[model samples]
Target: MVQPLSDERAPLEGVIEISTGALRGETRDGVARYLGVPYSAAPFGDRRFRLPAPVEPWEGVRDATAFGPTAPQSPYAGALGELLPTVAIPGDEILHVNIWAPSDAAGAPYPVMVWMHGGSLKHGSNALPGYDGATFARDGVVFVSVNYRLGAEGFSVLGGAPLNLGLHDQLAALRWVQAEIAAFGGDPRRVTVFGQSAGGATVAALAASPVAGEVMRQALVMSGPLEAKDPADAGRITALIARELGVEATRDAFAAVDPDRLVAAQAKVLAGSSPLGGGPAYAVAIDDDLVPVSPGDGLSAGASSNVPLVIGTTTEEYRLWLVPSGAVDRITRLHLAIGRRAAKISAAAVRRYRANRPGAKHGEVFGAILTDVLLRRSEYRAADARAAAGAPTWVYEFAWRSPVRELGAAHAVELGFVFDGLAGADSVALAGASAPQSLAAEMHGAWVAFATTGDPGWPKWSTERTVRVFGGAGGGATVVPAPRLDELQELGG
Candidate 1:
């Protein structure tokens, strides 16, 4: 599937036509790669808080090697910089897409995977290391990673600005795919949208959005579910944050301010955290026009129940965020503050977790319990809700521990593995030199399979059955975690 880069296959010299205008991209690794491909017009100036407008067609091919400047974002440090260069192109036109495809020049259709990066809606870009689409393209898929509004730019709920502008950016990208994918050797009819973390959450929103009907047919939401701040509550939080910015609590007034200044105010808000303790005060509002209401509710109500779904979480989904190197000893402290158990701590809930690892340390128990409570429970909730609505849904738990940090299958660890980009330092260190080759093959293959066909080679999950457990010796199985899910959800997580 790896086609040699050729003159004929490269984007027409200085004039490859995109939906908006002509673009010129550089060729690399036997693939014609296009960077900074605008999917939506600049969401700045007066357009700052409005729904994305169609980008004006340009007079000539625009260079797309460097990615556009990221939508006003604050760096969410994790190893992202080492994983991908934090090179920011100075521009307000940040909503863009990157494409990588084979180079045979033939005008044939290929499967497409539109990827959304995970950063809790605060920070991340499509132009990251582990996300490079060369491998997927080599594997015969047209790969696209997108940059939507992030943090305040994408998720801050301003009244005058379009709610869910990040989601709107995604829709714009999908519209571009429908209009111009054929030029990149992609099939408009066979598109699969996939994402992790907040990106996964966005995918969930898209699944439930009516506008998404003609945008994508299949979706894979990795490690994100339909649970979070209620849209109405989210709006209230944004208005409160806006008040902190000394701006009137109205969208029009907020939109009149500079995007960078608004972003800085948002950063201050995130830094301040919420006195109410709901994490940062930024995310898509239910916006009756764009998001209607709860995306999970919509999914369960049969709005997008027909869309094929592949959803899963890591075994220790929250371990990355919970048990940090400097924080193991802090578990007992948190437990004391939040109480060791949920509500009044009924005997049944205690028995559910305590009975399994009888001799485990308090910290271990807390970490495990926290992982189940916050992460896995939400994933199960989403899967169960969708399945109940008649949507074909697959659920999974990635239990492959990182060999390097011994981080016990923590958050974002499965990303490189699922993308088949585990040769890097963190991934190789955790997965080992060879790591679990079969696990990567199985997981990545399943992703590709889901993209190619609606089915991902697993039975659909339901209240009676769940499928896909990437755990055990080499870590790959398709089975139900019914008891674990029931136990975790019962804890009121």
Candidate 2:
């Protein structure tokens, strides 16, 4: 447990010395904020599409009062973009971390929680307005959010470049935290790395990484896919994009393309892809050197089994993509038949879903199948495997429905509550203006509690598969034994 800070709050304006140099930070809302601080050197020029190089030592205190440049990427397009907002700050120095520390918790070693923002391995950054870390800092924790390489720049398996460059960037940031967070009054030993969607997948992989020992103390995966692709399968996306650019699939060839042009070609190649059906999309891949095995295989088979873990999903994840695009309204019965075969869903299982979800439309039912197939089942299997391995694991389900665009308890709907950003405009874009604050308090409090102590105020996953449910038809947070066990078993089998 973190010791309480003295009643006297530390002065807000201050300079903290990290390894590279001293950084001057600003104060606001009783929190000390150091924004856009480079944890690694800019990955450009000779270093483009390569492992992150160390940040060169600076001469004077770097101006860190505002957010730094974000990784190169385009905005989320069309209707989905409307709900999930993004920032595109241009620059070569894109490997940065934004930090918020409690001014009142000075001199005390507060637990640190580092955030990984999710963007499907393509979009997102530390500069998103709703991702402010002040709330965690206010609650007596030092919070840090990281930005890494994305899309081809980060994930592509190239001929002469490292695999998982984005993941490597994240590891570098964690190493930086281990070396520097102490000066910010943080306990590096109590670090908890947590994230949503792709970010969640990232932490899962990190937990199983052979190098995870000294850097991270805990792991949390929220609605993140746990599968890692085979190198050849993963490289196919890069090959397609390279073909789109009429260039060879190699580091030198990709490095020659303009960053903007590469992402544009990537978008065009993936325009027809969807969560349910599509060609290869960018994802974490299995590499003999780094991710020797997939996270699910690693976690279940004892990799990082000793690490405390919290993994879960929203009730209706597929709605995030399906509803916004009018696909739900357009789904036909024939489409359901084809999806069942493609996703390997048994006819009996489809019948069960139809019966259980009485009055549900064809698209809604099919969407549920895709959600189970793509997301929910992955978390379920990971939790079960962790249980068998005798690891401490907590499972949760975010069931809060959003009135906006009928995105009921969708993939990222719980983000507003988790970050306690109901009043923020970014939160409003996804969740309606009247989203509940009580749920936010309960969920956020549970997270703070988990980071402070290994437990999330819920029973550990075991024979019962207990889950902490947040905001469903049942208004308050509750824990249920083996929720949806039968349905999950059918999907898994």
- lDDT scores of the candidates, listed in order: 0.71, 0.87
- In model 2, the Cα lDDT at residue 254 comes to 92
lDDT of 2 at 454: 86
Residue-level lDDT tens digits of model 2 in 1-493 = 1122235634324666678776778888789999889988899889998888898877556767888898878778789889889887878889999999988754469999999989989899999988998899998889999999999899988899999999999999999999999888899999999999999989988998898777999988998888898989989889899889999989999999999899899888888575555567888999886688998878878888778999999988988888998888899999999989987889888888888899998999998877777777877787888889788899999988999999998988888898998999888988899999999999999999999988889999988878999996789799997666677778872
Q: Which run of 10 residues does model 2 get worst, by summed lDDT?
A: 1-10
The TM-score of candidate 1 is 0.87
Model 1 over residues 193-286: C-alpha lDDT tens digits? 9999788888888887887679998888887656545566777657666777777766677777777787677666676342122355555567
Candidates' TM-scores?
0.87, 0.96
Error of 1 at 482 (Å): 3.8
Displacement of the residue 128 alpha carbon in candidate 2, Å:
0.3
Tell how far residue 84 is off in model 1, in angstroms.
9.4
